[model samples]
Structures are given as structure tokens and as C-alpha cells.
Target: MHAPVPGHVPADRVFAFNIYGDPRLTEDVQASYQSLHRDAPEIFYSPLNGGHWMITRYEHIFDIVKDYEHFSVREMQIPRIENPPVFIPLSLDPPTNLPYRQALMPHFSPKAVSAMEPKLRAFAADFIDEVLARGECDFVHDIAARFPVSVFMELMGMPLDRLRDFRALADDYFKARTNEEIGALGERIIGLMTELVELRQKEPADDLISKMIEFQVDGRPIALGELQSMLFVMFLGGMDTVTNVASYTYRHLAQDDALQARLAADASLIPRFVEEGIRSFGVINTPRLVVKDCERFGVQFREGDMVLCVLPLGSRDDRRFENSAEFDIDRQALTHLTFSSGPHLCLGHNLARMEIRILTEEWIKRIPRFSLKPGLRHHSRVGTVIAIESLPIQWPV
Candidate 1:
């Protein structure tokens, strides 16, 4: 069984607000780390999550993530996550990870994702068209969040209208403040996923969900619970990630007209902007358990110790980056740790990159400018996943 981290919290270190206790820990994470990384690059244990070792600097954190043999993904997930922790292949170490990833790899390849682009672009364009005439709307509800939800639903061959229904629970699941609440959200998504898997098993549509159901492992069909969990993870990862990326860009660009103009002037720069935006706002505060005792970065960890790596914080580490704190879109910072590093690097990364790049390009191409509406407050919460609750904005009709 996993136990709380054992180490002394440095006297100078101010404990970060537990990402689990409160959802607000995700927003402005850099500022939070800057407060801690000075005196302690690696906190012995954080008060958050019962004081797991918090990796604040880039070298130590990425090095651990890249070296999977020493730092395993098993039991990396919190027990409170919605789906049973079994679909946690992304959390799995190599050799074992290879087969599970292989089974689902076909769905996210460039060719497969590219085939869906026309449909995705059309969906994004239609979404833009709806909001373009309105002049003012919450970009989160109105655009940024909606596009990926619709795309994932379509990709899974699920009903498009059910987007709102799934999103309602998804938002709750991702923002679940308590372990009990997270479990309830998981039950809800699992119920929906069960229905989808059963239907797809019978119908076998030409979509990712059906393809996954047909995915054979060890000469037998993968079990329904496993398949459902995979679908749930896929839905959660795809929908939440792209939406957050778009929201990050819009929130930042809405206030920075000069930066917006620079991108608008050269649409080709949108990819770089998206990459940088991810570097700035990407939220994968995942943890890994040590397979055996190991030493790195002058710190030694014993077997079974949980090591938590904050991805975006590492991207800003001054040692690995030049002027790391500055948010220069053009700053070539070794391709940010946004998507993560090494073997278990996010599988949906290519599709996510394409979706954000195209959506940013299209949105800026049509709605060139926008501003955050006055008197409206935008709230960002950090949990297992970081998210923007609402983002209201106005642009020319």
C-alpha cells in the first residue's frame, strides 16, 4: 500500500495549496513554484497530497520521467480518479507498456488524425460562425471547449448532441474536489462508456471506440471494463487537453493585442504560439512510483517512493532554458515538457498539436481580435487536470 512521503519540509518553503484539496493550484503554477524553487529545487515532501516529493526544477523532473525503468508509472495515479486506475497504461512502465500502447496506437496516428481534420475543421468553422454573429460570448462555452468535445464525440462515433451531457459530467469529474466526488463522476462516465462499448460491440462502427473493442490482446478480445476504461481515459485526455490549450491562448491573447497582431500578421506562427501556450499552461501534474531505490540529481529515493513531476514548472527551469520565465512565443526552449517526455509521452500529442494549430489559425483568420469582457471574472482550478471554468470575451461580429 502507498504511504505518505517521509521527509522534512524545508523551513523556508511555503507549502503549496494542495492541488487535491483546492482546484485553484493549477492557475499561475509558475508563480507558485518560483516561490518554492529558490530555496528548495526538490521539496522533501509537499503538504499537498500528503507530502509527495515535489520536483520543481527541469533537469531532475524530466530526467526521472525519461528514465522509466527507475521511475515506474505503476500506482502513479491517485486512487480517487474516476475510472478504476487500471486504464492507467499511460502510467505504466516499459516492456508492459509497449503492448497496451500498441493496441490503441492506431487511433492516434497522423494518418488517422489527418483523415478527421476536414471534419474537425468544418466543426470548428461552424462553431466560429455561430459566435461570429453574436459579437460577445464565453469563449470557453462558446468555442474553445466546444470544438474538441465535438471532435472527440464524432471520432468515437458517439452522438454529437450528447456533447453537453458528457461535458457536464466531464467538467465535474475533472474538477472533482473530493475523492468521493471523483468516484461518483467516474461511475457516471463508466456508465456512459459501458453503454457505448456494448453498442459498438454489437454495431462495430468505423470509429475509435469500435476499433478499440476489436483490439485483441493475448489472443482474446480485451475485456469490457478495460475497454471502457480506455475509452474514458481517451475522452478525458482528448477533450480536456485541447480545450485548455485553446483557452490558454485566448486568455493570454485577449489582453495582448501586440502579440495577437504578431501571430495574425503571420498565420504560420500559430503552431509556435500553440507550442508556447502549452509550455506556459500545460497541466500534467502526474506522479510516478520508484521501482527500486535510485539516486539522481544528488537526491536518493527508496523503493516505492512516489515522485511527482510538474511538467510546466520544469519547462520554466532557468538551468535548461534561457530567460525561462519570459513568455516569448519564439523562444526555442527544447520543445517544452508540455506533452511530457520519454516512452510514455502522450500518445494523442500529434492530434492535439494539429487540433490546436488548426483551430488557432482558423479562429484568428476569421475573428482577428477579441477582448475579455469587463466585470467578468475567469476562474482556473487545478486538480488531477487543470481547467478554465469560464472565459467570456467579445470580438467583432
Candidate 2:
């Protein structure tokens, strides 16, 4: 039951923006995010997606994310879910969430990500090599889509041969038009994960699945159901985040010759470029369940309403970062909530940075200059994680 929305929030604030189905989400998402903070308050109610509160400012978002007791991450779905799948660490609160996060931390820390750089670079180079001679190719398919999926498959102990097939399924899963379609894809993904899990039980390898098999939470063996949920989160994240990030970032770079040339001449600046790119173009509106009645940020949040913490808008808040709209690599405050904040901060952040950095370094090194094919704009869809449709580009042979 929703407590009455405070009288302060006006009916005009009910903007009909649907993050999942909006075409503008992929086209000019930056402008779209800015519109939230344009004339609206820090938080507003959007009746779209069956009614939810949209958090528009960085300070407000940070507060709610830090206090999970009031704003629970358990129900992350936009439209919300009944008996949602419990994604460990991500879905749990406080002490219970710590151990699961700890078990996975070592693999994604800076040290581990650094160690994997060589292989990651090789993967990036090989992907770039495939399309260098063509002078024009779909950057999404040739590099952005495949490279991360390859690494994701390795990390999860899935077969590399299924890379192409998995990409197709992931695209469908994120862009599904109906609930039944989403359900079918979910079952298929879970089935594959189940097969991998069962295989690891009999024959463990030196992969994440093997480690999960050996991990114990709460001083006891992790439950199968819990383990599956963790894998499910990994499955969604692994295939989604970097794919859109790389496509969008590189697509931007492709169009900006001066920026591309600058990065090409001095590769050391690639990290800053990655940070700025994420800060500028990051897309992902995370949802949290209102566990109980509470008035936060001068807004009345009820027990059952969903609060969407729009990170892209929050990170770019001018109060936090001056000149927040423009992508300035040398910006004094480059930090952002692109991966989110607090206990639920993304553990995959280091790995994601590594992927984007390597791909940028290698792509610029090979094809130092490129641009979108004539008038072609890369396509994308807004959903779970915004999926980049295609990034076709051309350069001098």
C-alpha cells in the first residue's frame, strides 16, 4: 500500500518517460537525463512503467543507496517483481551481503585486473585485426560485442564456441517486446548456467564457477539457489555493461577527430578518457524497493513504491561536477556513480575499466582515425542494460 505522495510534488511532474521503451534513451540519452533536472525537483513521480519515483540528483541518490534498510535493493525490477530472484550481495543487505561480495572481490580487484591486462590487450588486438583491412565494419559486432563476451565466457567457464549464439540471445533478452519473450530467454540463460554449474560440480576448473563451488557463506556451503542467483546477475552484467559502454564511448571518439588523434598520440590518457566517457555517457537507471514508509529528500516514499536511482543524471549533476555535461578528460572531479555507490557499488568496475581501456588503446593504435559511416548513427535499445545495436564506421584503408 502506497502512502499518499506528499502535497508538495505536483501533478505536472508526472512526465511520461519510459526508460525501457523510449527511443530517445539510445539517441540522445545525455539530453534526456538533463531534462530530468531541468525544471523538475530532485525527485519526481513518473507514472510510466506502472508508477515509480525518479531520483534526479547525485546527493539524493547517494543517500538512499547508502541506507539500504529503508531503500532495499531486493526488488530491482522497474515494474517490480513478485518473489524476485534473490541476487546475492546485490540483493542482500549489510552483514549478509558482505561475505558474498568478499568472495568475489579478489578476482576483480585492481591487482587481478592488472594481471589480466596482457590477455585482454591480445583479445582487443585480435578483434581489431579482424576489421582493420575492411576500412569499414560494424564496431559493435567485430569488437564491442565479442571481446567482452569472450572474457565473460572465460570468467564463467562457458564454452567460447557459444559466444556468437550467446550474444544473439542476450540481445533478445534485453530487447524483448513481451513478458513471455523475456521469460523464455530467462529460462534459456538459466538452463545454460545450470548446465555449467552441474558440470563444475563433477569436474571443477580454474574458473569462477569452480570458485563458487568451493565458496561458503555464513560459515556453511552456499545454497544452490543462492549460487544460481549470483550467476544470473553475472550473466546479465557480463554481457551488457561493457558492450554499450564501449560502443557509445568509441562511437563518440570516432566522430571526434581531435579527441581520437590526441588519445592515439598519447595512450596514457586512455584511462582518463574511460573515466570521462563513463561519466558523460553512462546509462543504467537502477531500481530499489521502498521497504517501509519514509520521507526522504523531502519526498514521501511508501512501502511498496519503486525508487529508480538514475545514475547517469546523478553523476552529471553540476553541484558535484562543474561543467558536468561536456566530456572533459582532465576534469577535476571525474568520479561518478556509473557503477553506482555504497555497499552495492559495482564490483565489476575494475574489469570494465580494463576492458574499455584496452580496447581504446588497441583500436587507436591500429586505426588511429575513424568516423561513423557517412551518416550512420549507432543504434541502441533501452532496457535492463541499454544494448548498442550497431556501430558501423569507416576510415582510410
Candidate 3:
């Protein structure tokens, strides 16, 4: 059926590294991507999730992602062509996608994020205060998971009352045991978004939803479906990414006391510490659909085939990075595909950074120092975003 797997990659080299489960991330899951890069050929076929070609090095991924004509980001799941309604802007490629990004640019800009700092800090403080009195906490649920979700709820003007319900459903969506289960949870979220959109239509307000409703593409308001899809993307992303990266970063810090102490001593390094954490632990290996039959990096692909641009591999490429495995916060000017490169670079990056930076600052200022609870292990899950599930941590009060 498919053009006999690309790159002449031996059936032996092809591996199913269980993007989400296997070799579950310890101190850092990006290590798994690095391990994949070091061990496999530049390109190999894996029958893991319905047999897709995996790119190991950064060079190829950079070129491929920028050139979307050959590779489409429309599909993420393998062996399964399931759709819970694709998110817009992200799903749209180039020229057309630019306008949608432009419309939202102002809301996510540095200036806008700076203005929101007070609210962001307050949210962080509220959560930290709840845990500060208690010497120990499950950093994953108590902080990492709720912070971003709550922020998104406030930002999008979603009902404040439903934040907890939405967050729980989202958590379940990622950790769902079966495809059907994830599908059901996804539908519930989408249904709620539909209701929110209807309410906003009759009575608009000062929020992302209203802002989006004002934008007209080619002199026409965005279709309800398109608008809902964009909102869905924002909701889905807002709930997950920061939670994942924050947990992973803290887990790394939890294990390394010296680094943790250094960060506490010099809060100025928090930004770089956050940057390096994102670089090494950016756990998503973004998937793209092969729209038409073509050859890439010495491999032939067919229409409908899938290619996974393992972002972690690109970010940790040894050829471009020295000591790629070692987590160095003060490393020379960092270059990475952690937020992705090219057209699809994460638009929410600014907000995501602000959240992580503030949280790191707050943690260092308050905790003095902390570590993973004894005899407990940290775990990570892979889906749209790679999140550390439960980071049990303890600090002397």
C-alpha cells in the first residue's frame, strides 16, 4: 500500500519508541528524543502508531516544517484518522494563516503580557499560598496543571465557575485510557465552547472571544465553525502546554539541588533556566501529514502518509549543540525548535514564558530549595503536549 517505507531504513532500525509511554521521561524526557536521534538513522520507519517515518536530526525537520507544501500539519494521530474538529489558524497553512495570527498578535504581544503580569502573578501567588502553609505538595496538580487553565479561563472570558470542570475534562482528555474515551471528553469541551460562543454573540465583552469575533477575513466575519475552532485551539493549548513544561522543569530542578540553589540565589537566571528547560524537555515531536507523494531527505513518501518532525531531536541536535544531553542553564546563546520554527512557531509563546518565569521566580523566592519526595518517581505523558503527571515534591518550611 504505502511506498515501501522511506530512506531504505531497515526494518531493524525502525522502532516504536512509544512517544508517550515508553522510556517515560525521568529527569528530562527530551532525553528520549535525543536517544532516538543518536540511535536511529536520520530517518527511520516506526510502526508504533500505525507506521510513520520519524526524522531524528534537526537539519531535515527545520527544512521540512518551513516547507509545508510537501508536509502538512493537519494530522497528528497515527494509524488513526480521528478528528474532534481540527483547530483553525494552526491547521491553515501560510498566506491564509498569517492574517489569523496577525489579528491575535496584539493580545499576545510583550506589551499585552506585561500588562497582564499583575493578574498572572496574583494567580501564581494564590496557588503558592495554598501550598506554602503545607510543607509538601503535588506540584503537578496543585500548581502546574491549574495555573495555565485558570489563566486561559480568565483570558478567554470563559465562565469562571466552570474552570475546574474544564481543567478536569482536559486532564482526562490527555490521560484518557482509550481513543473513544478521549473522543468523548473532547466532544464535551467542544460542546461547551459552542455554548460559550452563542452566549458571547448576544452579549460581547472585553475578552479574546469578543476580540476574535471582530476580525473579518477578506471583508467577512470568520465563520462560526472557524471561530469555534480557533477558540478550541486556544483552549486546548492554554490548558496543557505550560502545565507539562512547568512540571518537567520543576522535576529537573527538584533532582538537582545545586542548580536549584543557584536559581534561588540569582533570580535573574530564571528566564534562562526556563529557556533551557524548554529546550531540553520540549516533549512534543509534532506530526505532519504527507499531502502528496514526494521524496524528502532521500526518502520517498506517498500522499496520505505521515511524518513526525521530532521537535526534541531538532532542539537537541548534537551537530548544532554541544553537550546536548547535559542541562546547562547558562549555556551559550540558545538556539532551538522548542517552540517550533517557521510558520507554525507557537503564538502563545510569550504568555507561556511569562507564566513559567513568574512561577519560577515565585518558587525560588518562597521555597528556598526543594526536592522530589523520597521513593517517589516522576512520570510524563505524550499527546498534543507532553506533561509530567504527578511531581510529588517536598521542601522544608
**Among all candidates shown, the one with the greatest TM-score:** 2
lDDT of 3 by residue, 110-212 (tens): 9998888899899998889899979999998899888877888898988877777887777787676457886787678778888988888899998888888
For model 3, the run of ten residues with the poorest summed lDDT: 1-10
Local accuracy of candidate 2 as per-residue lDDT tens digits, 13-124: 5656677765445465665668767766668887767678888788998898898888998887777645565777788888779989998899889998888888888888
TM-score of 1: 0.90
How much RMSD separates candidate 3 from the native structure? 2.6
TM-score of each: 0.90, 0.94, 0.92
Score candidate 2 by TM-score against the native: 0.94
Evaluation by lDDT, superior candidate among 1 and 2: 2
Sorted by TM-score, highest first, which candidate order results?
2, 3, 1
Error (Å) of candidate 2 at residue 183 is 3.1
Q: What is the C-alpha lDDT of each candidate?
A: 0.74, 0.81, 0.79
Model 2 lDDT, full chain set? 0.81
CA lDDT, candidate 3, residue 27: 47
Model 3 CA deviation exceeding 4 Å by range:
1-13, 23-28, 82-84, 176-183
Between candidates 1 and 3, name the one with more favorable lDDT.
Answer: 3
| Model 1, runs deviating above 4 Å | 1-17, 21-32, 77-84, 177-179
